[model samples]
Target: MPAAANLAVMDIPTPQEALRKLLLERLRPLVETPGRAQKPCGMQFRGTQLFSYCCFTTERIAAFETLQAVIGIVLNGTKEFWVGNSGRRFSAGQVFVLPAGTKLDVVNIPDDRRGRYEALIVEVHHLPPALAALPELPQPAARETRHDVTLTAELVDALSHAAHTLASSDHAEILAEHRLAEVLMLLRNDPAARCLFDLSLRERIARMVVAETTRTWTAEAIAAKLGMGASTLRRHLTQDGTALREVLATARMQIARGMLERGEANVSTAAEAAGYASRSHFIRRYRSIYGAVPSEHLAR
Candidate 1:
């Protein structure tokens, strides 16, 4: 077949594309108004799983540090990302997976027709039991990269069901988890998303701590939460070369830094948001990690 003919043939909307259209339509009620706020805004689904609706009125570039792994689907417009030194682009009908603790900048460009950029950001904290029980994935080299994959019908359907159930009932957490699990299981089979499946113990703990940054987390408490002995959890984290204290600090700092950057809170407010009681202590710790006071972010 001729190249032009192939393009014509492929231009037809796949079943996935059709379902994505319906999903976006169903989500319109929950969509935030563009330009109302600079920060991403949306709803939280199940525990630690967030399905945020991000809408930007104008072309905007922002830096983000992920505290948990995210699966983002662009519902409108396009996104260009720079991870480390590599660049990648994804438009409507595409999916991108970012691992926990990744620092990257992205430019969100609205399509001329829509005049706004829209996307759904799903924070995936941990794999479901079915996926977790599978064979462990090989650890890749220490490099920052984003996984790009074609959005599938199964994922769209799962999201649609999850959204509908949440909107209709007060007790929808269990049903929503099963639906989102289907979404994750689909991603697990994709080669590009294999990195997401290999979240380290340190990363998993980091994700959990960040969810409730205000809590005073002890090793025993965290271990009990994870269904393991305190000493055993400590040993495993030690093998990963990160201690519980360090992980907790890193997670809290990330939250404070993010809030400051978004202009949502001042140093004192951000410190409290990150679970700090004393302003001076938060400032000292912030300076130690970022080499600047929390006030510096406010200055921007």
Candidate 2:
């Protein structure tokens, strides 16, 4: 072959290819020998927003709601999402951003040829100071909206670097937050990215509850912290077709679910972290919301 043909044939991997390779190399060991770590489904950086998701079987987890906005990159399988009546499928190397408080059904299907699925997920909760300084931020609709993003090379590299940093460094929270901010900036122009700037009342309350799950949160206390009257807050939430109890329950369940997924805590520990003084109460509530007890869930 000519020199030019040889150079073209030996070209370096693209950003998408690089990301796929990076995730597979790092997460393959964890998936193969799950007992080596506490993780059963995937690995999570406790203090950071980064996490890995792996699945060998096709299971549809229905009505999975996002307590916080998240961005996910599919590395080794097809992730199918059903939001309301609409359905969409994202394949390997694709990215999707879901707004906070959105409810959807999701299924993880391993790659037909590879026989395994892996992905990287990052929760976007911290709004950068500069972005929050904007005077007029766009408000998303009360209903859920999905942002199917076309990742640029810069974005792909940012995600790859974040995964590497979190996986290798013991003290990576500050750096991880900075990297998360970079991700938000990259997708700033996209409509879905506005969730970080302009949050709805329900989502705002959810974020607060999730931040301090152990707190004995009451409507009056939450209202006082938000600088609003208790009655007024209740009125607004009522208008939104929810109440303080519902919000608190959902937020607590989200924390408990996260703890269980990480596999670092037992059911009792998760229950306490979720502010449930009674383990029985926590199990009943979890079953009502997630359709299974935490123990049964862990078995999966």
The candidate that wins on TM-score is: 1
Off by over 4 Å in 1: 1-11, 14-29, 32-63, 128-135, 138-146, 164-169, 172-176, 212-216, 224-228, 257-266, 273-275, 295-300
The residue ranges of model 2 lying beyond 4 angstroms of the native Cα positions read 1-47, 56-68, 112-115, 126-130, 139-146, 192-198, 212-246
RMSD of 1: 5.5
User: For residues 45-86, could you state the per-residue lDDT of candidate 1 as single tens digits?
Assistant: 323254554454554455656756777767778888886677
TM, every model: 0.73, 0.68
Report the C-alpha lDDT of model 2 over 55-143, residue by residue, as the tens digit.
Answer: 77787988877756788877778899897778888878777887777788998898888776777777776465555445665455575
10 residues in a row with least lDDT, candidate 1: 39-48
Instruction: Give the TM-score comparing model 1 with the true structure, all chains together.
Output: 0.73
Model 2 global lDDT (CA atoms, 0 to 1) = 0.72
Name the lDDT of candidate 1.
Answer: 0.70
